[model samples]
Target: MPGFLKAYVRWVDSANRAIGYAAMLLIFVMVGILIYSSIMKTVDIPPLWTLEMAQFALMAYFLLGGPYAMQMGAHVRMDLLYSTWSDRRKAQVDCFTIVFLLIYLGFLLYGGLSSTMYALEYDERSFSAWRPYMAPIKIIMTFGVFLMLLQTLSELIKDVAKLRGESLS
Candidate 1:
């Protein structure tokens, strides 16, 4: 691979790793939120935002961590036939199938951006009693999707390199 492509791969991997690690902390935050909610409920002082906030944290955790999961090859796959394939064969198959992934991510990004824009423009809020503005989470979700797209492209590059009997690392 060329110098620029190598740099791009390195940069994306580093950024996603940092984001993923930060996202991992959200699980603890979610747990704390739920625990607080439980304690408040026991005292007959349940907060209206606890449940919804916890849900939002969960969403952020997964979405933000997705790119790192893909980068680490932690995403699920069917192993019935794939586990038996040779490395070159796997690379070939990945190179071909990655087109579908790219297409799907493209559509997802488009829709996410549109929804995020609407939220920002209209100051959209959830229908829950807490009624928090939706733009912040929408923006985070869209950014996560964008990172996933970049990571997917990096994977495609790596697959192509593997097919050529080269190493990006």
Candidate 2:
């Protein structure tokens, strides 16, 4: 079971990395197009939907990278007060924070899924001329939140192992 979980995390990590790169590429392309289109528009060329794509891609970028950020422990932390504590206390604090974070992220997971489902049910699309499906992006947020929850659980296990004087790695 542990091996399976380890494999699953590896797969999710790989998948999120791909998503991150794709979102980056999308953003780059949209920005380039926006510049070109704006220039052409000024010269009486046909207006384009660059702004639409850029907004969508930017949201996707944020949603997709969330899980990767949590896994890396690169998220911002204001631990100055906690850092003064002993090692055992630090572990205790981490465990407590992880519990709260788990709850908060679970809420996000639920909300994102609900929004995605609504979008799908209503066939919601962007108001822009491009009109891409919004449900997919919403669903991505849900997936990312789920990944983040897994990461929190992993952290909790690590902290618990530390409390037990065990190597979580």
Candidate 3:
């Protein structure tokens, strides 16, 4: 592989790792919020925004964690059939499926970004009492889709490289 391509892969890997770790941490934070909210409820205190906050955090976690999961080969797959395939065959199958992946990601990126723009233009906010702004979450979701697209490209490159007997692992 070219030095630049290798470096680009490394950069993507680092970014996905950072995003995934942060999302994992946010899951814990969300759990903590839920626990706190439960305690507050038991104590007769209003945890008015805890549910909203947790839902938002959960959305961020799932979106941001996507690329990382793909990078780590942790995403769901048909392992039973895949395990029987040879390396070259596996790479070919992955490459074939990647087209659909790219298509899906492209649509998701477009929709997320458009929604974010609409939210910003309209000054959209949650309907709940706390009424937090929605644009940030939409933006984050768009960013996540962008990152996933990058990761998909990296994977495609690696697959092609493998087929060429040049491992870019």
The candidate that achieves the highest TM-score relative to the unseen native structure: 1
For each candidate in the order shown, give its overall lDDT on alpha carbons: 0.96, 0.73, 0.91
Which residue pairs does candidate 2 place in steric collision? none
* 151 Cα displacement, candidate 3 (Å): 0.7
Q: How well does candidate 1 score on lDDT at residue 49?
A: 98
State every prediction's TM-score relative to the real structure. Answer: 0.98, 0.75, 0.94
Tens-place lDDT per residue, model 1, 1-169, is 8999999999999999999999999999999999999999999998999999999999999999999999988999998999999989999999999999999999999999999999999999999999999999999999999999999999999999998889998
* TM-score: model 2 vs. ground truth: 0.75
lDDT of 3 by residue, 19-100 (tens): 8998889899899999999999998997789999899889889889989999999998989999899999999999999999
Q: RMSD, each candidate, Å?
A: 0.7, 3.2, 1.3
lDDT-sorted candidate list, best first: 1, 3, 2
Give the range of the ten consecutive residues with the poorest summed lDDT in model 3.
160-169
Error of 1 at 87 (Å): 1.3
